[model samples]
Structure formats: structure tokens, C-alpha cells
Target: MKIVKEALAGTLESSDLMVRVAPSPEGALDVVINSEVMRQFGAQIEKVVRETLERLSVTEGLIVIEDKGALDCAIRARVQTAILRAVENPVLEWSALS
Candidate 1:
């Protein structure tokens, strides 16, 4: 997805990471993160993801992210991208991709 690529190249700061956002037809968003970076900014990542979701207003689905060493900016951007991608296209799987 363009958003994810942009996030990785433009926003992801610490290291390479994988991000996914799956939205249910109901418009609910579920977010998940796992990685070394998470050990540091787990809570912040969740907040950013949730906030992004709230902004997107997706009703339902799972948003999963596999962060290697991405910074908060990276996570935020990726989450935004993933959410958009998920909403636009339904082919992507919303799971922790490593």
C-alpha cells in the first residue's frame, strides 16, 4: 500500500516494521502491535492507532502491526496508512506480520 510504504520510508524511524489495519463492515477497529520497539512505546503506539481509527471512523476489524524498531512517528504514519488501505481494499490480512 502507498500509505504503508510512505510510512516506512517517510515516518518509520527506528527500524523496519510491518503494519496492517483490517476494518469490519460494522466500522469497528481493532489494533495490535508486537516488536522490540513495542517494548518501549507500546502504549503510545496503541494510542496513536486508536486515535487514527477514531479519526478514520471505521466501524470494525483488526489492525495489526509488527514493529522492529519503528518510532512513534513511524507507528502513527503506518497506522494511518494501514487503516486507509484496509478501508479501501479488503485483500490485506489484519494480523501481526513479521
Candidate 2:
């Protein structure tokens, strides 16, 4: 899905995370992540984000992840939510998300 505009999901509260997505002017995916557990889970968080984006066929966007010790599932959900919000006339295919 293409990011047509800026969108946000989730929150910065503990055990939760915030995802921000916007169109990339450079036509490339740019991801930034900040997490309370970065020392131990930073790579995992980045991997989850990248895999989620790939599954959604996201090619170009600026994604920012703010994590407060959220689980991988939460990260995926937040990213999916933000992507849906950022797309125009989004048509979600539930099976594809699996």
C-alpha cells in the first residue's frame, strides 16, 4: 500500500507503541525506531517493522516507530493501522495480512 498522507497510530504509554507514517519524497522507505528496550530488542523491532511493511507491499514511505516495550504483535498492529490510515481508499485483505 502506498502512503498518500501522514498518519499515526497507538501511543507512547508503557506496553504500547506509536507508529507514524508519511509519504516519502525520496521514493524510498525510511524507518526510524526509538524504544525503551533498544539495547536488547532494537534489532528485533526493526526486523518486525521491515517484515510487516514488506507484507503490506509498502515501497515508499517514512515510518517512525516509538516503542515503550510493546510486543511484536503490537508493533505489527500499529504499523498496519497507520498504513491503512495513510492510504487512500484502503481495501484490506485479511488473508493477506496473515
Candidate 3:
């Protein structure tokens, strides 16, 4: 799915993460992550983001994540939510993505 516009999901609260996705005309996946645990779990976080995008069949977009110690599942959910919101479709069955 292609991102049509900028969209955001999640919050800044503890144990949560905020994800922002936007369309990229360059046709490249660009991800930027900010987290305190970058020294240890950064690669894992990036991996999850990339995998989620691939699962959604998204090839070009700018994904920005502000992580507040969120778990892997939470990151996936937030990214998915952002992608859905960016697409602006109303009939998508979100549970089916799992």
C-alpha cells in the first residue's frame, strides 16, 4: 500500500511509541528512529519497521518513529495504524492484517 499523505499514530506516553508516515516521491523507504535504547535494540526496531512495511507492500515512504520504550508488537501495531491512516481508507478490516 502506498502512503498518500502524512499520518501519525500512538502517543508520547511511557511504554508507547509515536509513528509518523508520509509519502516519498523518491521511491525509497526512509526510516528515522529516536529512542533511548538505540545502543542495544536499534537494529531490532529497524528490522520490525522494515518487515511491517514490506508486509503492507509499501515500497516508498518516510517513516519516523519516536519510541518511548515500546515492545516489538506495539511498534508493529503503531506502524500499521499510521500506514492505514495515511491511506485514508474506511473499509479496511484491520484484524485481517495479523
Candidate 4:
């Protein structure tokens, strides 16, 4: 699914994160991440984001992640929610999301 509009999900509080997504003018995936745990978990967080996007078949978009030490599951859920909202009426494939 392609992102057609700007969308956001999640929060900035401790143990949570915020996900922001938008259509990319560059026609490629652009991801930016800012996290409190960057010193220790940046790579893992990036890995999760990339994998999630790939699973959803999202190849082009701007994804901004603001992390506050959230777990992997929360990150995945937030990314999925932002993508779904950005698509603006997604036809979700339940199996792929798993």
C-alpha cells in the first residue's frame, strides 16, 4: 500500500513512541529516527522499521520515528497504524501484518 497523505500515530511519553508518515516526493523510502535510547538501540529500532515497511510492501514514503524507549512490539504497531492511516482506507492483509 502507498501512503497518499500525511498521518501520525503513537505518543511521546515514556515507554511509547510517535510515528509520522507522509508521501515522499523523492519517490523512495526516507526514514528519520530520533530516540532517547539511540546510543543503545538505534540499530534495532531501524531494523524493525525497515522490516515492518517491507512486510507491508511500502517502498516509498517519508517515515519519521520519535522514540521514547518503546519495545519492538509497540514500534511495529505504531508503524502499522501510521501506514494504515496514511493510506486513508487501506485494504489490510491480516496475515501479512503478523
| Shift in Å, residue 9, candidate 4 | 0.3
Root-mean-square deviation (CA) per prediction:
8.7, 0.7, 1.7, 0.7
Separate clash counts for every candidate = 8, 0, 0, 0
Candidate 2 lDDT score at position 26: 91
lDDT of 3 at 22: 93
lDDT of 2 by residue, 1-98 (tens): 99999999999999999999999999999999999999999999999999999999998999999999999999999999999999999999886476
Full-model lDDT for every candidate:
0.57, 0.95, 0.89, 0.96
Model 1 Cα lDDT, one tens digit per residue, 5-77: 2122123345756775543455445566777756678887778667655655544676677777766666666
Please give the lDDT score for candidate 2: 0.95
Per-residue lDDT, model 1, residue 11, is 30
Runs of candidate 4 with Cα error greater than 4 angstroms are: none
Off by over 4 Å in 2: none
lDDT of 4 by residue, 44-89 (tens): 9999999999999999999999999999999999999999999967
Compute the lDDT for candidate 3.
0.89
Q: Among all windows of ten consecutive residues in candidate 4, which has the lowest summed lDDT?
A: 88-97
- Candidate 1 residue pairs that clash: 24-60, 26-59, 27-58, 27-59, 27-60, 28-59, 28-60, 30-63
